[model samples]
Target chain A: MATLIRYALLLATTAVLQRLLLDQIRIADVAADGFLVLSVATGVVAGSRRGAVVGFAAGLALDLMVLTPFGLGALSSLVAGAVAGSLERLIVHSARTLTLAVGFASAFVGVLFFVLVGSLLGGVGLVDGHLPVILLLVPATTAVLVLPVRRLIRWAEAPSRALSPALR
Target chain B: MILLLLTAVTLLTLSGRGFGPLDSVRSAVGSVLAPVGDAASWATRPFSNAWDSAFSHDDLVAANQRLQEENDRLQGQVTQSAIATEQLQELLALVSIPFVGDTPVAHTRVVAGTAGNFGDTVELDKGSDAGIEVGMPVITGRGLIGRVRLVSASRSTVELVTGGGFKVGFLVIGTSAVGVAQGDGDPSRLRGANIDIAQPVTEGQIVVTAGLRGSSFPPNIPIGSIASVRSDDAARQSTVDIDLYASTRDLTYADVVLWKAAN
Candidate 1:
């Protein structure tokens, strides 16, 4: 129950931040996507299944907030989360740098997936010569944000484990 | 993962097909979040403005100079226009005349500047409740900005003319030439085509809506002024670039013209 509430709060807060504040601030017409960064950070801390679930939920919330089609964000985020989680085992040896690496990589994957899928679905302006700018900005912004966001996700997950080890 | 993928696909397909419930869901979500967004914007606007001003002092100075010159020029034109208006009014007293200014409009505030990552659109505070409907043209004091793309009970989205895929018929003032202007995925200018190469279109010439039969926009809605013109020898057509009179970056308010194009 505690984990669920934390996840709900995370989703809501990220949605609000993405929609109201971050979207208003643009660097060369491309705003950093905080929601995408948070989801990728979630995958960095959690395993594959949990990561995919969180990503799906995050995508749905984003879809609801934006004017884009219903499932574009969802599909892109799910793929990104799952891919990031699957790479967790390999990066466990380099655990010290895990969050940063996964954050950048997963954000790259997520944005690429978004552009490919969005263009296929007839979305305009996704490839209007800003693709390279978006690709670099989204991931670099995610990389800068990964450490704190990862800690937040871990903090949200930590209480549940302490409350019931057997439940895990 | 497969189930989630299937669900996402189902949603994409359904929404693309214009499923009614999906629209309702979007509206419900907007209604719930609009106030929260407004509050956040109000709280953060000062910081954003300060950040912009800090980085853009030189640019702002240059822009101020440009505007001062333009203002001086326009003031001269306005005086001439006033004289012409008086003359035309006396002549029009002989017959009844309907003017574009007589069209009903709903003045609305822009609640949010840009909504999503994919396209350039702004959110307005008024929607169907204020007679704003999809396809209605929106304009500011400077010129036309865009058209209403989506509307809910109390809010609506206006797709800016700079958004890729926005196309509108336009005519060059003082010429018989007409063409279609379209956003080229750039926020600063629009690309125009289908113009006859022989047409004497010059830089800084005004462009206004053609408002042909079955057009979505009403006639004489100012879009922009020609920035450049290039002749396409093979096609015998001229490619014109238009610099918009309205800047989307700092839009705070606009009027939604309630007039719809006649079929």
Candidate 2:
């Protein structure tokens, strides 16, 4: 129950931040993907089921906002979160490199999955020509931010874990 | 069981089947979440305001001076106001569509945004209780921003034109070059496709919303201007770059175009 509450709070907080703050802060019209970073981080720290659950919730929250056919984001995030969670199993140490690598890969897959599903919906076109560039940049960008994000996630989750016996 | 139930709910909604419970669930969730969103927005409002203040200092000063000069010039034109008012009255009389409608403009504040790298949406502080609904077109003095994608009782989400899935039919002012403008997931970048090669397209051409057949958008609303145009023989279709007139960076408020087409 405590784990569930933590997941819910984390998901809600990230959704609120993405909606309220991050979207306004653009550098040359590019805003950081705070939710994606958090999703990956949550997956790495909390394990696969929790990660996938949070990712799905977050993505569904996004689907409610955009015009795209619903389920595209939810599915993509679910898959990305699961992959990140499994990756955590392989790495013995949750070092900066491991976290970054997982984050970079997950972000790339998440974006790609969304684009592919969206294009198939026939509602609008993807930035098909820039796919390669986005693919390259998203992972690299996520990787660069992973260290700091990992630290923040650790700090936030530690107290919650201590408070909740289920976290053990 | 929870995953299965969630998936079932999601699938049902996605398939266009009416999930009666979904609306209630969404409303309950929205009301509970609205305050948190509002508080977050309030916290960040100062930072954005500070950024805008610092960035627009010089420009604001120059603009103030220019406005002062323009005011002086416009003072002379005020003498002909009687004649202009008569002309305006005549034009108003000529318009066939009823200007008066049920839709009332309600101001809303930004509450939140869509999550992840697909950053193309913002949440508003207003919701169904405020008479907002999905498909309501959102705008500002500059031009169109987007439409309300979803609404709860106390909060709503707006999909901006900078999102990947947004598309608007547009026309290049001087030429009959019609194309579809799509968001490049970046506000500074927009793409217009389906232009005919023979059409005389040029840089800096004005683009306006080419209202679709029986669509809600009023025709000729300024959409953007062509930043660049490209033609390739291989593709047989030209692409034009558009620079949006409205800056999402400085967005504060938007008007919900409440004119729903009469059935």
Candidate 3:
């Protein structure tokens, strides 16, 4: 329950941040992919299933919150979450550097998926002549954000696990 | 993964097809989330404002340019006022005719902004309950913005003039030429069609609503100013490019004109 609430707050905060503030703050004329980073980070930490859940929720919020295609965000997020989770399954846990690597890679996968999917969805010029900048920003921004986001999700999930058997 | 992926694909298909049944769902979700979106904007207002102030040197410079224009206009207004007063005093010696009438109008605030880069609509705080119909024009002090595209009980959707499907009958101000201004799926660029080849159109010529009978918009609202004009000799018509005065990027409020087309 605590984890659910924490993730919910995180999703809402990220959506709100992206929409009202960050969308206006353009870097190289492209908005930073906030929800994608969060989804990828969550997937890496919580496993693929939980990560997909977060991605789906955030995607739905994104669709409803803004005027993009109704299902595009959800689709992109689902893939992101699943990819990160699959990566988690391959590596042994508990190495800080590995976590960061996973985070960066997850972010890259999520962003690349969104860009490709968005373009294919008939977004015509969805690349907007800024694909180079966007591609560079995606992994770069994701790298910058991965560790912090992973930490936040970890922080949120930690107490729940410790208190779980005790409280129930 | 498969199930979630399938579900997402189905939803995407339905959304892309614009299935009518799902409109209510979109509206419901939009209605539910509207408050949250507003709260987000409200919370970030101060920060965006401060950031724009502190770090936006280019914006500040552009703002100064606007201020300079406003100053010159205000100075012109002072001269016009003095001239108008003298004219009014002279007119007092003659008979006066006062004309007055009111057009139907319903003022509304913009509730939510464009959805994304591809967003072509804006959500309004007013809906059918306020007598906003699907075709009523939306306007601001500057000029025509768009028309009502969708309306629910407590909210409505406005199709900005920049939408791919949007078009308007436009008159080139100070010239006899008229043309159909249309959106090219690019918000910043509007294309004008059917401009008579013989009509000389220059850059920066203002355009306004034709207000033709049976049209959605009323007459004489400014649409945009001409940006470019090119003659297609084979077609015997000059293609004119227009730049709209209203941009959804910074819009926060609009008025829903209650006027309907006269059948």
Candidate 4:
């Protein structure tokens, strides 16, 4: 219950920030996605299963806010989180390098999946010349945001850590 | 993971099929978040303006100078009162569409724009409570901008004219030619295809909405001006490119013209 409440607050806060501030801060006409960064960071902090669960919830929250097809954001975030969490096992102990690698690769895969799925569903404008710019920027932006978002997720999960028998 | 994926797929399928209950859920969520979004926007506006000023100071200065010159030119043109009044009415007729006469318009501020990379859309701060509904034409003083795509209790989304698959019926000024302009995923252009090769179209010719029976928009609403005309001999048709009059970027406020398509 505590975990659920913590994640809910985190998702709500991220969604608000995305709408107001992050959406306004555009670089080369493409804005950074705070939801994607948070999901990827959660994956880096937790494991693959927890990452997928959090990612899907986060995406669903995002879908409720945007005008896109209802499930697109959820699917993108879910896969991105899972991929990033799965990579956690193979990453070195250096926190900086791990977050950056996971953040970039996961966000890239997530956005690619979104475009491909959206195009197949008759989203004619989804795949355009500006795709290269989106591909370059979304992941790069996600990487820059990963470290801080991961720390926040870890802080939220601190209670769960304290209650775990192994930690005690 | 499998369970979650299945859930997402289910949601996509239900939403694509136009499930009505989902819209209620979306609206409910929007209602909950709208206030939070408004508060955040109010608090962060100063910082946002600062960021814009820091990056685009020179551009703003140039724009201010251009507006000053335009103001001076208009002031000089106002010479005699009676003549100016007649000309003012004529200018008003030219700028405002006749077919949109007395239609109740709901004015609202644009709260947000394009949430993701895929679509060209913006969100307005007023919704059904303000008499704004899906399919209503949104405009500024310049011309038509887009149509309302979705509406919640206090917010709505508009699909801009440049969004893919958007089509508007238009008539060429001073000619009998009519064509449908289609958006092809380009931000700054619309294409008019299958136009008769013999049509006398040229660069700089203005285009206005047809607003014929069953048309989406009202008649005489200026859409754009022709940028280029190409004759495709093999297809036996001419294609015309248009440059839109009302830009979609940086729109702060607009009016939702409350005329329905079927009406």
Identify the leading candidate in terms of TM-score. 4
Error of 4 at B21 (Å): 3.1
lDDT of each: 0.83, 0.69, 0.74, 0.83
For all candidates, state DockQ relative to the true structure.
Answer: 0.60, 0.27, 0.31, 0.58
Which has the better lDDT: candidate 1, or candidate 2?
1
Name model 1 segments beyond 4 Å from true.
Answer: A155-168, B49-76, B83-99, B196-204, B231-237
DockQ of 1: 0.60
Clashes of 1: 0
Query: Against the true structure, what is each candidate's TM-score?
Result: 0.86, 0.69, 0.71, 0.88
- State the fraction of real interface contacts model 1 keeps: 0.61
* Candidate 1 global CA lDDT score: 0.83
Q: Is candidate 1 or candidate 3 better by lDDT?
A: 1
Q: Write the per-residue lDDT of candidate 1 for residues A74-94, one digit (tens) a residue.
A: 888888788777777567375
Residues B1-263 of candidate 4 have per-residue lDDT tens digits of: 99999999899888788887777787788778788668766877888789779999999999999999998987777666548657656775897645564578999998877876667888889999998877888888667788998788899888898887578888888786788998877777888876777787899999888887899887777788999999988877888999988888889998899978886
Q: What is the C-alpha lDDT profile of model 3 across B1-263, one tens digit per residue?
A: 67778877888788778776566666666666567657766786798788878899798999999999998999989889879756755663363311111366778888666554444678888788899887888988677888886677778778788765678998897788988887765667788999899888999999988776666777667788999999999988998889888775668889888888888
Rank the models by DockQ, top first.
Answer: 1, 4, 3, 2
Best by DockQ: 1
Native contact fraction (fnat) of model 3: 0.38
Interface RMSD of 3: 3.3
Q: What is the TM-score ranking, best to worst?
A: 4, 1, 3, 2
Instruction: Give the Å error, residue A26, model 2.
Output: 4.2
- lDDT tens digits, residue span B1-263, model 2: 25733783465355345444544455566677677667767787798678769999898889999999988988887878758756655664696422222246668876566534454677777878888877677777566778776678777778788777677888788788888888876666689999888787999989977665666555556677889989976877789999988776556777776655434
lDDT of 1 by residue, B1-263 (tens): 89998999999998788787887787788788888778877988899789769998999999999999999999999989889867766654565533445579999999887764677888899989998878899999778889997788899888899987688999898898899998867777899999998887999999988877788988777889999999988999998999998887778899999988785
Candidate 3 residue spans exceeding 4 A from truth: A1-13, A16-30, A47-50, A87-139, A155-168, B52-103, B109-130, B133-136, B147-159, B163-188, B193-204, B209-220, B232-238, B247-249, B259-263
Tens digit per residue, CA lDDT, model 4, A8-98: 8998888888877777678888989888888888888897788888889988988887767789889989999998898886786857876
